[model samples]
Target: MLRIKRLDIFIVKSFLLLFIGTFFICLFIFMMQFLWRYVDELVGKGLEMSVMAQFFFYSALTLVPVSLPLAVLLASLITFGNFGERYELLAMKAAGISLLKIMRPLIILVCFICVVSFYFQNVIGPIAQGKLGTLLISMKQKSPELDIPEGVFYSEIPDYNLKVGKKDRKTGMLYDVLIYNFKDGAENAHIIYADSGKMEMTADKQHLYLHLYSGELFENLKSQNVKSQNVPYRRESFREKHTIIEFDSDFNMADASIMSNQATTKSMGTLKASIDSMTHYGDSIGRQYFKEAMGGAYSQPSGLSKNDTLRIAEANIASYNVDSLFEAATLMQKQKIISSAVSRTGSLQGDYSFKTYTLETNDYQIRRHRIEWHKKITISLSCLLFFFIGAPLGGIIRKGGLGMPVIVSVLVFIIYYVIDNSGYKMARDGKWIIWMGVWLSSSILAPLGFFLTYKSNNDSVVLNADAYISWFKRIVGIRSVRHLARKEVIIHDPDYSRISDELNALTARCRAYVNTHPLRKIPNYFKLWMSVGEDNEMKAINEQLESLVEEMSNSKSVTMLTALNNYPIIAVTAHVRPFHIYWLNLLAGVIVPVGLFFYFRIWAFRIRLSKDMERIIKNNAEIQDIIKTNNNL
Candidate 1:
């Protein structure tokens, strides 16, 4: 049995509070996005409140899998950020608790969340998606509420266009209405002009009732005698007329079975069954097509085997010339033969085209089912991957609240979204393998999570801007001038004799190294990269130079300290090779572009090194001269 620690409880409670809040916030955001995509279908359908409630509820359920990973990322980031900002993490570490130890409870929590995500994706998500899809189709099929504006034609009614010149708002009456009816075809249209009319829906809301006070109606009549020159029609005037138009305003839910075959409406088990069935179906169709191609047009003639046909063709090979035979034939016979060949070719082409289309459709469905099957597992794993990344990153940055965490989370999530979406499209289009495309985002982010966790656990300065800046400076050979100020209080005075001897030895070493190495000449390319060793002579010279500067700094003289500041800070191993490992150096050398870049970079460093050595020699001579002058005084 495992005992629960107070520390674990505290960590878990803090994470849960934040997780609940972030989860809902993320859910609402995704739901709003879903609503925006189908807003047009829902806007004018006049759906009931209960229907809308179901719409959003089902939408939330369908969006849960997408929202969970982002929620985990943000919550973990804020939780760890708060810990680091308040120095709570520092205290825990001081008390001998490791970062990984403190994160143990949350890791377990995230794993549970992953399990829940998978369950929702495989079980709950499909049902909700089916319901949502059915609801959307019903909404789109439902007629818009009847509202005819003044001076505009309303075409919302089927087969009719009505324009109202004016209306009475209180009485719900129309004035100067013009209506066109094309129910009997446009050629036999009916045109009506009504002085006043009122429109209302029937009790069942399945038909529209139109009552006109005074109107003139013109109806076109189709002529029975085709040869007659005169067209016939009818005109009638009515003081009161009632017309019924077929308009169904009542909301009727569509058949949910219509969406049952959709890939989004299937669970993992169903998806596997569907994929197997479709694959078998596709394979059978492929084999049928192959058999037809082999036997239909390309087969030997009736009662003749392939070998018999080949033997007969070989015997007649020299006796028949198709071009000469065509020239010997009558023109009409040649035309008949050409027409027959063209007809046969067209029939065969159409048949094969139909078969190809059928196979492609079946194969596409199989890919969809396979893609959905892999999606259930990949999306769940992303939740765990995101937590490791967020927790360590938050600890490294040491920021809390919404400001920094929100920005970082958004950027990271955007990267994940882009990679995941691109891979999804690629896989769906069959441009990439199903597993590789679906797993692309997880593969890319797994290493990042590991790297951040390792860096944060070791308390490394991975996120420090100064560290990167220093590295960039070193890479570009940008050296800094040393600054040494005179001390007002000194514990020990410098011995001019000892400093003088050291400076002479350092200057002699620098001159000898610079002279022998010939830094201005180009180095051997192979030796520069493949050979790996530090320049011990330059290393010893730099050490001695620094020591001499330290001893001379205690002098009371201001000029002596000023001369000490001019000594250049030498990069010990820069001029030798790009990396310490021989393989890495060889890799850089093998790739021409990369090798060329490093080669020129090393050459520039060599030039800088030569200048640095000259400066060291000059600074040494100046200090030695100052020491001699002081000794005489």
Candidate 2:
């Protein structure tokens, strides 16, 4: 017990060291990826160092749960792998400590980590996500510094475009400036041309003011009364002009409260509350839509019957025949009736379209919130799941360090990431159910984790290289002859010539039977497949030959032994009988195409069986001749 305690301590200590290092390393990698994504928005904006520090802090916090699973995966893999590689695991197992017992301590640690991850996701994650979102918005709103280039029109300013031909930067002078203004409206556009201009932002950094040495202002008035292509316009010439453009160039942080309404920025409790509220709202709207669709009530005219329904009431339709109604009414009356009916249908269609869109939008929002709610738990639970996967996988592979472990870990994480991300997007887009999409990765990997753990505990060589190589060989048409060990038996004085004669007669009979009784009729195959039957005569002959060969192997005759080697072993592998696997028949019957496939497949097998019988006859004839030659001597 003392030794086991020491070993447990050593394992935990080793795992902790690897876990800490792997955590930060994985965190750094994720952080670098995050940086790459937002570097464009973050770089060269003159952001304060403190703000950048805060951004990095929140970003790291957000990535903790993200990196936790992979870190635990890598760390667990390394820990167990190092143990296995150094034969420490073998020693522990040999000393009566099972793999599960060895895993007990680390499993507890991982469970604790899972709880902490859940807490982080529910508490810290939302806050960091909220803050990060707010900061990013603030950054996006922060205008680029007041540096306008020459030649191209710079329109970063609100509703205005400006161009400068040249600038004397040393003296802060400009030449040949053109400006376009559409602040009021695009149709009421205003253009300004100047020989020289200078632009500067206000001291408050809220606006840009342009001063021109010589400029002309032109404006167009939009009017519907003007029939000509050319509308009325105004022009003014000035030796010097000034224009002011609204531009907020300061970095003002947005209110975090502004982002509090988003699902990503909400805690699990908040998300649940919102989901319930929205669900109730959606249900109410759906009920209302159904009520409206069923035409619960309508303000019909006083003369209309109460029995009249929404979609062509019996009395109303019966009273209307196009030819008779047209004959009864004047042309003007008919036109009026048709127009009223068309207008009414058009109104109802527009109303239904609006209601449908409203319901769809509400349902989509509900799905997104529910998706996020499930994501909170699933992502947290993934830490434990990945531990199960990585730990057993490492024990199975029995490799350590940065070589195979890295590749396997990365590939597994990539598959998990792809599944999780795809599920998230699909759920958010309403393509999949909330729970299904949110739990997709966990659901997929949980069984895999169990399977690997089982294999590891059972000491199964699931990743054996030789097994895969054998399968590969079979795929490419390479077949090996089955070899059997020779049984030690006391040779008996037997009639070798009689044995050979019997073998030759059996082979000729089997060959003749196979050729004549080959499955020539399609109905026979169907009957055999349906009844799960085989040719009993051939089966009896095969059994007789096997027994005869067994008896003759004890003969003190070399020719007999050589002949036995040529004869093939046989079993009833012909048809899947009715009393066989219920599910197989059910599947084959349910999927008719596959059943037909098997039908033809069995037909082809019968042909191959006939050929096998022929080969047996030829080999038996050779054996008979060999024994006969020995007898003649």
Candidate 3:
């Protein structure tokens, strides 16, 4: 049996606290984004508070799966980041605990979250989506609240346009009102001008009642007896006129069944079933279309047997050229034949176009169902993937609080969102396979998560700038020169006689090596790669050079110390083969491009080696001269 330690408990508690807080933050952000997309539909409609609350509730449920992965990423980052910032992670590691052990508990929690994410995506998500869709459709159909502003024609009403020059807000009365009623038709519209009016909705909220005082009405008359050029109209003046306009302000919830067939409103099982049914349906439609085309468009004509039609078609093709026949025909006959062929071609085209549209619609539905099925699994897996990435990254970065972690988390989430959305569109439009598109983001990020985990566990300086800079410099053959400062305290003075003898030996060795190697010429390709041993002679020379410099650093003479610093730090084996293994070198040489790269690299190193040998010989001579001068003093 495994026991839970205090360390695990502490980590679990810390992650949970952050997870809960960050979950709400992420959900709110996603909800706001979702709401913004449909703001036009929801705004200006006189929806009740309870209806709005239901809309929000269903929207939140639908967005839970998307929000969970981001929450996991952010929470893991902050938890591990705090542990690293407080040096708690270091302390645990120092106490003989591995990074994996510290993370085991949170890993379990994240796994549980992943399962919950799947449940929400597969079960609760579809139902909420259906309800939300229904609500949005209902909201879109509902009429806007009645508010007629001054100096603008209000056409929100069904068949009327009313303009008010001014209005009394307290008394709810309009002034200088002009109304155009197009109930019958635009040509026979009734125009009314009122000096003052009061508008109110009926108790049923189904009609608007407009009462105008001192108004004149002009009504166009349409009569069968009247001539078209001389139309009659009716004009009436009244002290007060009341007109009833039809307008429904009441909100009616749409039927949930309207959105029941949508792909997003289906569970995983339903999606699979729907996909199977749609596939069969699409296949049947395609076969039917092919059969129809064969029978109708390319079939034998009426009263003609198959053999007879085939013989006739063959004879026509062999005996006559259609262009020559057309040229021989009369002009009217040619025109008639052309018109008949064009009509037949248009009919076939239209028939096939309709068939193609039907098949495409079925295929589109099948793709959507397939995409949704893969999405349920991909989003759940993303929760786990994100935690692995965030936990390892936080430990690597070693920064806590909202600032750095938030920025990193947002940047990472943006990349995931972009890739995921692009893949979704491609898959939705049948440009990519559904599984590949839905899982694109996860596949791309999985290796990154694994790499970060490996680096964090091994305590690698993966984020260190200086390490990358040094590697880059080495790759580009940019050498670094030594800068040695003179030491204030010397325990022992240098022996000029002993140093003089060593310097002469070193100078002779450098001269002999440079002459034997012939650094100015290119090395033998086969021997350079197929040979495996390092440049042991150069290695020994470098070692001996460093030893001499160490002993000479205690010299009292400034010129002697300066000469010691001038000896270059050589890359001992770089001028030889690329690697120590013969097989790797063989592989590199067998591949022409890689061989050429390493060949040029070796040549460059050879040139640098020649320069280094020259510097060493000169420095040795300077030191020898300095020692003689000190001896003379």
Candidate 4:
């Protein structure tokens, strides 16, 4: 028990180390992006440095959910890889520690992480985003320093264009400033050519002043009366404020986006307001429908029978009147009132149907948001899945190197990420049920991880080289034998009257042919060809014999008899029924007999040539002996 505890402690520690490292690494990368995005905006607006810092801080907080799952997966992979490398898992297994036992502490750690992630998602994340939005909004109104270079037109405004020949940066003095103003159809609208100008902020910085010196403004009026008169000219000084010019409304609180859900949860009052809004809209629709049913209530009124019973019944629904005419008119007016109410009620009912449909749509959205609301927790739980994947994969591979495991882990993670992200999109788009889309990836990989883990735990050799190796061994252990006819051979007594003389003669002939003629150019002394097995070689040799037979037939000079002399080969090959296991009773036919004949013929020719040389040597020696004998005589 103590030893098991120690192992669990070690595994947990490793997981924590890897998890924390990946978390910080991913956090740092996201933080850098957050800084880059807002830093320039802050500087451009001349906002206080503190605002930029706050922006980055809050932005980083919002990005946590996206980074957490990726970090968890990376961490689990590294942790398990380390264990597999050090052989600690092997050691634990040898000691009879079950896989489930090893996973106990890890699962507990995942649960703890999941809880923390949930808290972060629900609490810290929304608040941080809200604060970030507020900070950016506050900075948008601030005026930035304008460094207008000489001899270039600066179009910072949407419709107006300005060019300054030169400017003193320190004094904010402008020289040779030219401003072009556009009009809704004023031909030659207006141009202000100033000798010099200077800019200054209002005491409260609510406005900017461009004071000009001795500059003439030209305006071309299209009116004939004005055109015939003197052209309009004036010395101009323009003043505008940041408020008059609209800046982007982008960086606002986005409170509606962030707080609606939070508000929905806080009190019944908030939900009641949304419900009431929907209810009110429903009532409006019902009213329209009711009015449509009433003849000409919502439409133009048409003259109809005033004495009709339904109209009369509805008409007399008023206080007493003077006479018949007045009484009828009053009654009709009263009927209209009742008709209006009925019309409103009918419209309200239709509006209610639409509202119900919309509410179902919203409900689907809310269910989908269960994942978004708990995104961090859900993503963090993926750590358990990854742990299963990494741990088992490491065991199966039994390799500790970063190269292979990292590649494998990345591939697995890519698949997981693709599925998860795809499901999320489908859910968001209402294409799939929220539960299926949000948890689909997890559902898939979790079981797969478990199966792989179970397999690894059982020490099942999922991939082994033995099966292939055994096949090769079987192939190597084969040999081939030619089918020899069962004609009995007996050595006949050296007399001609021997009964078995014919058999002996045939045996001698076959033996002489085998010995004298070698079909192959060179024999494989090692007989490694036999290692290829008898069946395969036999097949090959038979193919060669068949091909030789065809060649012999094509070339009439190359008879089977001549082939037997050149290439000595023999096979007791018999034909078998197609696709059948049974063999046919067939005699040992002469296959590639011509090749065997050539083989023996060459061997005999070479042997004879050697014997002839020996004879010459013997003759020379005999001649020498005879000469010696004669000389002695």
Candidate 5:
């Protein structure tokens, strides 16, 4: 007997419940989409309920493979996100449970799901596909029961167009009816016009009886003589006319074997066999084409003697240049030769076109079969891939419910869907190899799964905005310092009145300098735009602030010392400011985009510096006030 842990049971219970709901929800959505594709065939045809039921059943089975992976992805994401959101994950971690250990039960369940999905894909998917395909064919071939509308030409019947200007809804009476009967042939059609008419079905529903009042009939006599080039027409006017039109309105089922050879209808074994056979056939065709393309060199002429053949083979093609020959020929000879050449070219072109069409069709068919083979396995494996992706992503985000998880899942799946669809199309169109295109999404997303898993396990703050901003500042050579004292330090209160006055003066001077700064003008901006140079103005302010902070840290009051310590060391950089290279303006004008971007960066930096100086001045004033109060005490 095997023992199961309570933790495993608890986690499995949560995941299973969510999985069941999500799977059914996904199935229902996909089935609705599937039904929409054939709604035209299913509706308005009076199809038997049994046939409709059969279609829906098969459609559900066919859609399972597509829906399963997405369901797993959503369920796993939501489950983990819930754990993280409720701090269940934190409690588990506190209990010495690693994320992987906590996820073990759910992981096993997901792996089991993947295996079941593969079984369905390999065993059941093909049969369901076959049944659905047969249903589609039957629906297409089954002639729809007639329901002719007014003001539209009805061409449902073979080779005939029936039109009625107005239809009486209650009495089934048609007014101003015209029928173009092209059953004999379009060129030899029989035209009939009536002021009023009534249509009725025969008891067996095999034929339609059209009873018209006050009608004229016109018949083309060309059908009587097959050799007749000219159409002889006969018209007759009658008070009453009756016509019997043959139309089969029965919902007949088509043969299932008609769709057996398609990619969707084949089992894995059958698909492999077909691919092998097709590959061999393609190779044979290629060899034959190559032989033909090798021309007369490899295929000897039948009438030539050995010596004559040798001479012909050795002869230069330029010696018989057609252009020169035609130019030198008499007018009559040239006309005859040109006519013969044109006729021959037409025949060859037609032959090549037919051959090209055949080869292209075969090539695409082989690609489809191979793609299907890859699809069966890849789609099954996607269940596992998606789980890893969504679980780790949810863990990292620590957001639950439909709000964040749903948005993130949708975005990730959309990216995969777009890449997958594009690659499949490229492969199908012969722009890429079948396997490479089929696995393109997997290739990109598999690595992403690994990365997310690693980050989640290590608790990396990969998505933190402040971390990224700090990194960006560091990369761009901007300097900063954090203030955290290793131990408590007491500050001795000193010259509070003088310090306050000096702080006030510093703020005033900094403000004044900012407003009167030479680099604040447009001409200075243009100069900076063309070159990168150091600004002594902001540096002077930063140095002055730094010196004042150093002086303030020497106070004996602990509160004042701590308050001063809380303020960070500040530095300003004008990354895109003016430089001393006069000739660089010419280069800046040459590359307008780079010049403008650097110019903007510098301008923004200057503004930030101006703000930073004012903030520093204000912060210093507060420190001075704190020191002054402590000194008075």
Candidate 6:
């Protein structure tokens, strides 16, 4: 229950943040739209005030769906991002809470939101869109406030055009109004002339009242002329009282597109019927292709050719793939196209229409439309998918400052967007199955997010300990191997230079091998005990090394002599591959031998000096045979 409450709080907070932020942003966009549409008419064309107000209101409603999903995504990200940044996620982890346990409530909230979003898509969204469309149409038809000068006439309204002059604002009156109302046929159309008139809009702005002091209405309804007889004509004059012209009903509920809810998609049943019809047509196309393959006398063709019966079957397949063409067209329609107004009409050629017509007969359009419909449903469901991905990712990247997290989120989203759009295009072109195309990105990303989250939950220190140590050494001027104390007393006059030369020779051999193979290069200095050469290399090298250590001991390097006497079983094993370069192994081999040898040499010298100092203190006998070996340079 406590867990449930926490999740509830999270979701509510996320939704509110998203809703408020998106609403203001979308509202501003809608206001700009309203201004752009009627601004020219309002300023230049002198359009009225009421139309502008209605336009904005309708525009805002139509833009809700587009902004809603974005708001939801942003809000959810911020909420979880804040939690992760604050180290609350770490605290939760320390308390032994599983990631899934933490995210459970959030997922439940998203599910509820999914239902709400679906409702908006199916119900409220359509109504708002319909109203917006109707409002735009009305704005196009309605005239703004007439801004005629004192004594000039203007004629711009088409079909039954009017020219009025000398307007009086106080009485809403005008003089010399010439109205031209056309009859059925332009050959015998009659016009009306009014000497003076007063115009007033009704309360609802539907009807117009014309109070003409003197006016004549003429009608020239053409009749069959019997051998040069005059055509029938009628004329009527009106004076004094105003003539009320009732405009068409302004607010017919039935006239609103929303009243015919299924106009956008005829019916839910129609979509189902369309799916069924397409399936049947696909089956029929398959049958036709089969029948076409079995040509007369059933003789197999020697080679593939368009004229061959099998080739005809293939052409039939291509023709049946007219569905792909229709699907492409449907996608193109859904994608907003930019074209000049002058080029819009009659742009679709006769051949194009005929091809479309034939395809429609075979249920091509319905299949294409079904693809679109499914794509939309999938896109909407993607919101839920992204939420899953984002929430999990946030928990994982726990270093959630705005900068890193936001950058990562945006990059992920960009990749997702590109993939999803590519899939959508492929599906539209019939290059991919509808479900596969629509769901591909989400399917790929969701698993990736899960893997990342799981990896993040595991305890692994990402920083390198060796690297940190190296940095410390560089900073403090510490050497890799520190110097130790020396030893006393000389035992053997060993050729120390010869042993050193042999060590160098062995190192050079390793280097040469490394140069040739390039990948298997490691020193084996400690392997003096392992060599079984015909020259007894191991025994000779060990004896030479022992003698060099004895010389160093006599020179009072105590550590080296103590090491040689205490631990004589020195062994080395080296292996190298041509393709694999294990650099750390190479480093270890170089460092360990060199480091230990120096330390032992120093200790042996220190021990020798201590023994000489003790002999001097005892005053029993002078220290003798402390001879240093010289190399033949």
Off by over 4 Å in 1: 1-4, 287-295, 298-300, 303-320, 478-633
Q: How many clashing pairs per prediction, in order?
A: 0, 1, 0, 35, 7, 34
Candidates 1 and 4 compared: the better one by TM-score is 1
Q: Candidate 6's residue-wise lDDT over 1-633, tens digit each?
A: 686577558656755665477447645865686568666544543444565566666566555544444444545566566666787767767778766676666667667766765655556655665776665555555554445556544544334456776677887778878766552666566566788887766778666766778788787756676575677788988776465554432422225643333323332344567667677876676576456435522446657564675666555554577556656775555354334333443453543466456555555455455654564465556566766666655554444444655666567667877998898777666778777877788688768756655655663332235667876753333434323245343466445555455545544443443345322223334442233333233334445544444454444434344333432322211121111235533444457675455334333433432332233222211111122222221
- For model 5, the superposed segments whose C-alpha errors exceed 4 Å read 1-4, 38-44, 151-153, 159-198, 211-243, 288-299, 302-311, 319-336, 464-633
Candidate 5 structure quality by residue, lDDT tens digits, 488-519: 55455346677777677778878877778743
Rank order (by TM-score, best first) = 1, 3, 5, 2, 4, 6
Q: What's the lDDT for residue 492 in model 5?
A: 56
Better of 2 and 3 by lDDT: 3
Task: Estimate, for each residue in 243-289, the C-alpha lDDT of model 3 and write its tens digit.
Answer: 89999999998998999889999999999899999888888888888
Candidate 6 deviant stretches above 4 angstroms: 1-68, 119-158, 164-166, 175-178, 184-196, 201-207, 212-249, 253-270, 277-356, 361-364, 392-432, 440-448, 451-633
Task: Report how far residue 165 has shifted in candidate 5, in Å.
Answer: 5.7
User: For model 5, how many clashes?
Assistant: 7
Q: Candidate 6: global Cα-lDDT? A: 0.54
Q: Write the per-residue lDDT of candidate 2 for residues 290-396, one digit (tens) a residue.
A: 87766633545456566653334445655668688578998899899899989988988889899889888887877877887887899889999998998888887
Prediction 2 global C-alpha lDDT: 0.80
lDDT (Cα, tens digit) per residue for candidate 4, span 1-633: 787788888888977887887788778877887777766666655544566677777777777765666566667666666666788778877888887787779878876777666556567776776676666656654445555568988665544567999888887878888877664344555677878877665555554456777677777655547446565444444442111322232333333354444421322333345545655655676576567545443333456454554555565545654456545666778688679889988987876687677656655545444546434445767766777777677666666545666677778878987998998888777788767888888899889888888887897766345655755543332223222222243242122123123323433443443455353344322231112222343344335444433332322222222322333232222111111121210111122354343334434443443343333234333433433453465
Q: Model 3, clash count?
A: 0
Off-target runs (Cα >4 Å) in candidate 2 are: 32-47, 167-176, 182-197, 211-243, 255-257, 289-323, 326-328, 421-433, 470-633
Report every candidate's CA lDDT: 0.90, 0.80, 0.90, 0.57, 0.79, 0.54
> Mind giving the per-residue lDDT tens digits that candidate 1 earns over 22-135?
999999999999899989767877889999999999999999999999999999999999999999889888888899999998999999999999999999999999999999
Return the TM-score for candidate 5, rounded to 2 decimals. Answer: 0.72
